[model samples]
Target: MGVAYSVGEVDHLYTFFVQWSPNIYRKRNNKSSSEKDMATKKTVSNSKASKKWEIITVKDSKRRLSLCSSVDSEAEEYQEEDDALPVLSDHSQLLDDHHLLKLAAHMPPRTRGYRWHLVYSTAIHGSSLKTLYRNMAGLDSPVLLVIKDVQKKVFGAFSSDPFKVSKYCYGTGETFLFSFNPDFQQYRWSGENSYFVSGNLESLQIGGGGDGFALWLDADLYHGASFSCPTFKNAPLSTHEDFIIQDVEVWTVQS
Candidate 1:
């Protein structure tokens, strides 16, 4: 009922089937290897893209920070330029141009841009305390008192209120004392005393405490004294504690 085959024919058919199976397996293996290679390439490309973005982000951040610092530096430079030298009404006998520049740099911010007007000068008005007081009358603005001693040591006081005869000490903490013994020195309120300034019929005082005065001027405006005082914590303003006044000037800052 079945057709008979020779052994050679059966062996030949088996050999053919085996060879064909191997070829199909090789093709499948090659396709899988190709897919794996493509996947690895895609991963590598994605990694490269991520690193590029990261580097760009870091660079952008640094650029922004540098820009901000540059802006701040420019703003600071502009502010310094705005604070120029102040204008004086006339030449000063006690203060030269260099001294005036240094003193102007230390004045209150509110008074920096205004003009300095000479109200009283011993060289012009003569040496008299009464005359000085009369010239300061009705002036509600700040005043600068510059004194040059016989030793040529220069010192001064910045008074918030005009000098006048007062029973009690009167002046704000804005009052300060300064000295220029070849170099400029400023003494601000020490917060140790409220005796910033006081005036009497006989004398005028800038600061007081510890049984002494920072600056004292006699009625004649010809003699003066300076000592370490609690109000400004300043050393003796003059070369000596008591010195003869060679020159005196009072300047008022005006609008």
Candidate 2:
């Protein structure tokens, strides 16, 4: 026969069982429960980190796009600005026809003896013909004389020195006459606006024994002029019948 345990011993055993049960349960749950908790925490942290990274990437991308857009806009604006201005060639094309026609009218009338004529005119405000002549004195075949007529209200000689005559002529008036020897070999040119008339004085070159002489006339003397190598009879002591003119060439230097 076996003896039964006392009540105190039984109570103690039940208490120990209760405590042991909890320890065993804790040991069993530790592997999966602790791992699950760690996974959840890692997931939450990773999610937060990923969201932060995405925000940064998005902001950086937007910033870069904005910068690229601004640059493109600036370039377009510059192109538009450039397009709005007139080109140099276009401005030249738009010159006043009246001015050109007037210059054409100033051309010395065609004569039987003259070969060619080139004419130019410029306002006195910018450059002086005399200065231009001085600059062009060393070029090949320079103008023999440059007649200057200052149409301005001022009355003063353009140049008083006679030595300066070799290059240019200056005067205070409305019209001036220029005579040039095409035979010159060296002339250096300067200035902006001028008129040139070129023709061969074939008869003038022959020297004497001609029906008429070449004459340069200022028709309006004050505002306009005409040059012609007219044919006239050759007679002694006659003001009009002295020499004949022929064959002129006018050209600009390219060098």
Candidate 3:
């Protein structure tokens, strides 16, 4: 017969090319498993937006460390109220004679050369002139009097009767009336107790039995005397003798 019809047309065409090569390799392995599930959902949404930006950068670094510890505790309470406060002058009263002749006309001229020692006859009494005018007026704390000289003679000796020819001299004259003590040791001679005249005779001058005489007159030497203490209450005055005052006279007294 023609050679069995060409061997049955080569066995049908080799079984239709072996069933179309296994259906095109199962549709290319289902399109590579749907592109590996869309690249694992874009790497799990970029790891949840990088864990929500590291939880808002750890809450803005704990609110900048609690606002820098509340600005370092209000700058240490304004440096402890600028270290406290009070400075000069403030006690009450008792440093007068035009403020001791404006503090012996602003002292500062004693290159250290003067000494006429003879201290203590109660050391200038009146309870030490109220404790040297409450310590030169510093009321008893800050002081500084360096004037080196200022005087007026005859500090003591008043017995015209106990058989002593003529004695009644109380500090003679050249302007002498001081006050400074709150412990600068002592420097009192408020003319003995009181009298800065014209300012209306300040008082205390009897001069005999009731005993009184603390005078300080000098609206420019209007006349002055009385280094008294005929018993001015507590009495004190007699830094013996070394007259001449002024050089250093710092202030503050009355502790």
lDDT per residue for candidate 2 within 46-152, as digits (tens), equals: 99988776445888999999999999999998775544332221222112343223222332222112221221123221233343334434443212122223321
- The CA lDDT at 123 in model 2 is 27
What's the TM-score of each model vs. the native?
Answer: 0.68, 0.18, 0.19
The TM-score measured for candidate 3 stands at 0.19
Kindly list the per-residue Cα lDDT of model 1 for residues 1-255, writing each as its tens digit.
998889999988777876879787667779999999999999999999888774458889999999999999999876765565667787789888667777888878878889898989999999999999999999989999999998998999999889999999998988899999989999999999899888987999988877789999999999899999888889899889999999999999879
lDDT tens digits, residue span 34-73, model 3 = 7887788888998888777744477788898888878887
Among all candidates shown, the one with the greatest TM-score: 1
Error of 3 at 108 (Å): 32
RMSD of 1: 10.3
Model with the higher TM-score, candidate 1 or 2: 1
lDDT of 3 at 42: 83
Best by lDDT: 1
Candidate 1, pairs of clashing residues = none
